[model samples]
Target chain A: MLDRDEDILKAAESWAEVDKGVALATVIETWGSAPRPAGSNLVVNEDGTFLGSVSGGCVEGAVVTEALDVISSGAPRMLEFGVADETAWTVGLSCGGRIRVFVEKVV
Target chain B: MKLATLSAINTERAARRPVIVVTDIGNGEQRLVRAADIARDPLHIELERHLRMGKSSVIEVEGRELFLNVYAPTAKLVIIGAVHISQALAPLARSLGYDVTVVDPRSAFASPERFPDVRLIAEWPDVALPPLNIDHYTAFVAVTHDPKIDDPALLHALERDCFYIGALGSRNTHGQRAVRLRAEGVSEASIERIHAPIGLEIGAISPSEIAVAIMAEITAQLRLPKASTA
Candidate 1:
């Protein structure tokens, strides 16, 4: 049966197939405030990926890391990034928000 | 790598997902179109209008040589309890086009005898969830207040990354439950994932009303563009 995540991933997959080799990222959890709620997803590919804004770009770098990891390992991971961190200044998100993402290889 | 699975419901194949497009027809415009088929296409166009407005509906599409309607499939709901609220929730969730599953460890409660058409599981979450492979597409609700049962299921859900994790309890129960979960080594952030007192504040006093509130919250959680549950 096609569940919502599967449907989103399917949508992302078709979008990527027309456009190829994209990385798929899913918002598994979120804290405080975020642009997308959990279960929302986006795909990133070699040239450029879908900018679904899982964490409003606040944690896209962390997600890119995990997306690349999935591309290489075929293993999925859950990632978390937020404004309440020493490195928050570098991340440029100061809204006291956090997002957890699960990146998986979308074949 | 999950391959996309599509419902074979479309009348014609498109290079991409087809969007229902409708063109208004004047009173004397194309009366040659069949009475039955005329409404089909126009209604589908109206459906597309609903979809564009952020409402879900079935719509018709019309192009030079093509005519059809697109129906986006609905989401699913997986409930981890066979409690009273769940009994009421199962049909409601199903009515919303959400595939529903009700899980419970107590055989007396989870038995198919009680929930005839519902997917009822008679095992603990550790035994059940692994096989189910709860994913982000799924919503996990723990209605059984028993910590021994609901906790392990929630752990599996957290690990599997279910989209929604709601537990039924009062303010006092949730506080102590948080302490227990913290003691179990669940991270502060992961512990925060739960939506305790599981339903919205609607002065719900009946099991059915509570079910409505929970489904409403789930709908809200699912619709939000970004997911932040703190």
Candidate 2:
């Protein structure tokens, strides 16, 4: 967790230093067969560039889209995706698990 | 998510201090909390529990959900022998995310060429262990059969709070070691903590297999319940 998550934080610092809009998405909770465990992070820039992962590859696109909005709005968003949810197919979390990711602009 | 807080987290991590980045999901507010500061923090009790376990987790405090991004110092493996088993053990421990240090007074065995990319301290255990600052996250393994070398290292490891202390020897040798330690005024309880015939009984014969067994035992000691290990 430290090794990879540290990389994410370091990347965020670098991006922020360059004046790029930045947001951080963190997997706050997971239930049953979640690919990545809770506390996994995905750091995103306004340009759609990112580092790290909250879910292996499943929910990253949706998280990034929300993160872009978060960067513009300066508001945090909590997103829940799972196979049981209606948007599961849309978000591609067909792995039979639930994950709650919180995205917030880095201040 | 302040840059100052992120910088503080990096600084604390570089210093090998246990830290937690507590993020309030609702408000997007975050603060860096070091292990030293956890006691005075409002979430002291909860923070300390996660700190000891060395795991990042989420918890609720007064109806607010907070993410605790724990950053404990990487666990350390301090090998006392620099022998064949140490060769295997160092890399294995490194792969398991432990910062490994190989200690041996013998320059021939503790050469950089022999253990490339690994920290080597070519000093006797009594002279070497003090500076290493052995702590709870450390796993101390005495692979050198020589009592002169292994005993002092064991004494130092026991005195400190090393989570695992394993000595490579037969049961007979460990019995003799027990007598020697007792004579040296080391307590029975402290002596009992030593995992003699180190490693799980996986019938390991070669050095690599022995290293695997030792690592497995250390992992069990690290992750399992005390009653289960007992």
- By TM-score, the best candidate is 2
**In angstroms, how far off is B68's CA in candidate 1?**
14
- The predictions' CA RMSDs to the true structure, in order, are 22.1, 4.1
- State which candidate has the highest DockQ: 2
Where does candidate 2 chain B have its weakest 10-residue lDDT segment? Answer: B48-57
Chain A TM-score for model 2, please? 0.94
Docking class of 2: acceptable
Error of 1 at B38 (Å): 35
Per-candidate DockQ vs. reference: 0.11, 0.40
Per-residue lDDT of candidate 1, residues A29-104 (tens digit) = 5677767665456666655555566766776776776686677676656566776666556774557777656566
For model 1, how does the per-residue alpha-carbon lDDT over B119-224 read when each residue is reduced to its tens digit? 8878888887787766655778888888888888888887866668888899899899889888888898988888988978899989999999998888777655
i-RMS values of the candidates, in order?
A: 14.8, 2.0
**Local accuracy of candidate 2 as per-residue lDDT tens digits, B33-64:** 87778889998877876776666778988999
TM-score of only chain B in every candidate structure:
0.69, 0.84
Is model 1 an incorrect, acceptable, medium or high docking prediction? incorrect
How many steric overlaps are in each model, in order?
13, 0
